[model samples]
Each structure stands twice: as C-alpha cells, then as structure tokens.
Target: MGIMEILMIIIPTTLLWAAPLIFTALGGTFSERSGVVNIGLEGLMVIGAFTAIVFNLTFVDVFGAWTPWVSLLAAMAVGALFSLIHAVASITFRANQTVSGVAINLLAAGVALFLVKYIYGKGQTDIIQRGFSKIDIPILSDIPIIGPLFFSNTYYTSFVAIFFAVVAWYVIYKTKFGLRLRAVGEHPMAADTMGINVTKMRYYGVLISGALGGIGGGVYAQAISSDFGHATISGQGFMALAAMIFGKWHPLGAMGAAIFFGFAQSLSIIGSSLPFLENIPNVYLLIAPYVLTIIALTGFIGRADAPKASGVPYIKGSR
Candidate 1:
C-alpha cells in the first residue's frame, strides 16, 4: 500500500484503538494527580467492558442507533461503582494502595469471567451488533489528503476523547477545584492546612478514574472487541497507566502518548495484512508497545515523576 493508503487506514484505526487508552490515561492522571495511585485501572476497564457489553446486548433492540451512547453512560456508572471497591480499601481502610488495586484487578477479572460463563455458558458474551459508526465530515473530509486523514468518518469515541482531553486540561489548569486537587496530591498536609479536604479530593480523583476507565473499556469493547470476555481488556489498563506516566500525567501529553500506543497496536494487526509485513513475526509486533512502555518508564525519555503522595493512603489526624 502507498503511504496515503496507509495514512488513511492507519490514522483512523490508530485513533479508534487509542481512544480508550487516552481516556484511561487521563483518568489515571486525575487519580495520580490527586495523590492516589490507581493500579486497578485494568480491573476498572474489565468491569467497564462487561457492563458495556451487557448494556449493549440488553438495550440494542430497544435503543437501536442510540445504544452506544446510552451504554457509555451505563459503563461510566458501573465503572465508578467498581472503583469504589479500590477506594474503600485504599482510601478508607488505609490498605496498601498497590495491593488494593491488584485485588481490584483480580476481583473484577474473576467476577466478570464467572458471570460471563454462567450467563453465556462460555467465557465470553455474544458479540453486540450496534457500535460507534464512522461518519465522514461534510466539506472537511473532502479537502485534500490531509482532510481525509483528519476529518473523515471515524470513531465517535475518539471525538469524545479529544473533547474530554481539552476539558481535563482546563479543569487541571484553570479551575479552583483543580488547584485543590493537585495540592492534595502533591502535599496533603499543606493542603489540609489551607482548609482543603484531602480525603475528599483523593476520593473524587479515584472515583473519576473509575468512571472514565469504565467508559474507556466500554468504548473499546463496542468499537473494536465487540464482546465482553476475560481477554477483551487484556492489559489495556496497564498500557493506559504507562501512557499516563509516559505523558507526564498531563492530559494533552497523555493524548499524544495514547495515540502512539494506539498506532503500535494497529501496527501489530495491520502489519500482517501488508505484503512486506507478511514475513514478520506477530509476537514481536504484539510486544512492541509494552517494550516501549518499559523504556519510557526507565527514563529513556527523561526523568519521570508522579505525585509525591501517590500510593500513600492518608490516616486522619496522622502524619
């Protein structure tokens, strides 16, 4: 295929795949920025995928074209509920945050698998028919090559992701709530002295992460996977966490990193379809993004830092 052809196919596919990662990374940004570490993102996504699939299957007949939109909200709610498991453990009980997150991952996976097996009589759900459809923008998609590349019909979730990114950036930089949230993440004691509720801020942060992570998983399922299965989420949460760290916990930065990883994922599948890539091993392609994540975490790009208070649960009235 020519470069243009690749661009046309690659760009849309990359954005579609990356949408979940970008949103999930941004969700991580909220939690980590507010001084809580959320390693349970993987679990949150799995829960989201299950919930989305359930909603899509249940409502598609009634909702018709509106299924994906309604299901997205359902995904967000279920996701937030699932996240509360981690929050109660980490924030309220003062358990090891990392351990709590790991528990969530295992719990979500187990619960989802069991439910799927019981209901579907298998390890996966029936694939949903309704999904986000690509729509070409009127004049914008018809311009030049770049138009088709940028303005053509694409995953609605990607558009929502971009919108969320911009909003996240604004909320982080411009809002008073943002300042307090960052303060709680960076220096809870100092923020407490300023009359800010550190506990509340952290809770809000993590809850938002769960909500977004769920939507992220749901979006991924509807747009790509089409089914709720144990393997559907498959490490996407960690990829999002890595993307968040890779992007320095900034919304726009996370977006860029997510897009990069998305393209990496696309490369794995799309490569096999090309004449030149037919000979390359698929295993190497599958592992490339993860390898890049490791390199990024190891400071190949530069010094990477997280909130100083991250992973440290707060005990009321204790230092």
Candidate 2:
C-alpha cells in the first residue's frame, strides 16, 4: 500500500488498540496518585476480560444488541471487588505494595483459569456472539484526512477513553477529592494533620483503579479479543503500567503514551502489508512496544517522579 493508504489503515488500528491501554493506565494513575502502588492491574484486567466474555456469552440473547455494554458493567464490578484484596492488604494490613500487587496478579490468573475450566468445561470461554462494532461520528466523520484517520469506522470506546482521561485529569488536579488524594500521596502525615482521612483516600483511589482496569479488559475482550481464555489478557496490563510511568502519572500523558504503544503494536500486524516495513522481521515488530516500554522506564526519557508516599504504609501517628 502507498503511504496514504497505509496511514488510513494504521491510524484506526492504533486507536483501537490504544483504547484499552488508555483505560488501564488511567486506572494505574488513580491508584498511584493516591499513594498506593497497584501492580496487579494485569490481574484485574484478566478478571475483567474473563467476566465480560462469560457474561456476554451467557446473556447475548437476553440483551440482544446491548450484551457487550452490559457485560462491561459486570466486568467493572468484578474488577473492583477483586481489587479490594489489594486495597485491604496494602491499606489495612500495610503489606508490601509490590508484593501484594504481585499476589493479586497471580491470584487473578489462577482463579480466572480455574473458573474457565469449571464453568466452560474447557480452558476458555466461548467467543462472544456479538462484539463492539465501529461507527463513524456524524459530521466529523465527513471531514478531510482527520475524519478518515480518526472518526471513521472507529470504536466508541476510543472516544470514551479519551473523554474519561480528561475527566480523570480534572478530578485528580482540580477537585477537592483530588486535592486530598494528592496530599495523602505526597505526605500522609500532613494530610492526616489537615483532617483528611488517609486510608479513605487510598481506598477511593484503589477502587477507582479497579473499576477502570476492569472496563479496560471488558473493552479489549469485546472489541479486540472477542473471547476469554488464559491468553485473552496476556500482558496488556503491564504495558498499561509502562504507559502510566511513561506519562509521569498524568492522565493525558498516560493516554498519549498508550497511543504511542498502540501505534507500535499495530505495526506488528500491519507491517507485513506496508511496503516499507514489509521486509522487516515479524519478531522485531512484535517486540517493539515492549522494547519501547523497557526503554521508557530506564530513565532514557529522564527521571519521572512518582507520588512521594507511594508504596509506603501510612501509620496514623508515626513520625
């Protein structure tokens, strides 16, 4: 394909792939911003994907065309509930945040697979009967290059992700709750002295993180994977984490970083078709996003600051 033709195909694919990352990374932003390090986003996403797929498969007839959307809600609820494990372990019990997160990831994987076997009598759930379809925006889709690149044949969740990122940014930076969340993250003792409830803010952050992460998984399953299995979620959760770090814990920044990763991911599939990349090794293209992630986290992009009290257990009266 010519450059313009290639561009047409690549942009939509990139955005489609980026949608999940954007949501999950935003979830990470919420958790980390509240001074809790949630490394279990992967597990949360796995549960979300599995729950969404199973719900959609089981209820497609009843929900008709809305099955996917409803399944997303189910996924979100499950994701939040599962995240409570991490919240309790890290916040209430004051366990090592990283260790707790790792446990969450392992637990999510084991439970999801076991449930798949128990419920489906197999290793994976049936493919969803219906999945999210692409649609063009009304007037904007009629625009020139921009329309074809962004508004045409795109998943609605892509726009929703961007909108939510903006909303998350507003909530984290502009609102009263956001102020308290930040205060707790930067200095829990100071926040406690100011009468803000440190544990409460942390819980709020973790719950929101779970909700968004679950939604991300649901969107990926409904729009991309179209099924639930051991491999359904793979490692997108970790990529989202990388995006969170790449973006310096800012929602908009995370979205941008996700888009970049999405672009790299898309290249793996489309590279074979593009004239310039046609000769490149598939291995290189497949690993590009991950390689970029490792590079981003290694300070090659300069040091990124995290919330000061992140991963630190807040003891109410301790100096």
**Best by the TM-score measure:** 2
Question: Candidate 2's residue-wise lDDT over 1-319, tens digit each?
Answer: 5666778889889999999999999999999999999999999999899899989999999999999899999999999999999999999999999999999999999999999999989997777779998889899999998998889988888999999999999999999999999999999999999899999999999999999999999999999999888888989999899899889999999999999988888898888888888888878866766777677668787868899999999998899
Return the TM-score for candidate 2, rounded to 2 decimals.
Answer: 0.97
* Top candidate by lDDT: 2
True-vs-predicted CA distance for residue 136, candidate 1, Å: 1.6
User: Each model's TM-score?
Assistant: 0.95, 0.97
Pairs that collide in candidate 1 are: 135-153, 136-153
- Please give the CA lDDT of all the candidate structures: 0.88, 0.92
In candidate 2, position 40 carries an lDDT of 99
Q: Give lDDT tens digits, candidate 1, residues 101-149.
A: 9999999999989998887798779989998878887777788977889
Off by over 4 Å in 1: 275-284
What's model 2's overall lDDT? Answer: 0.92
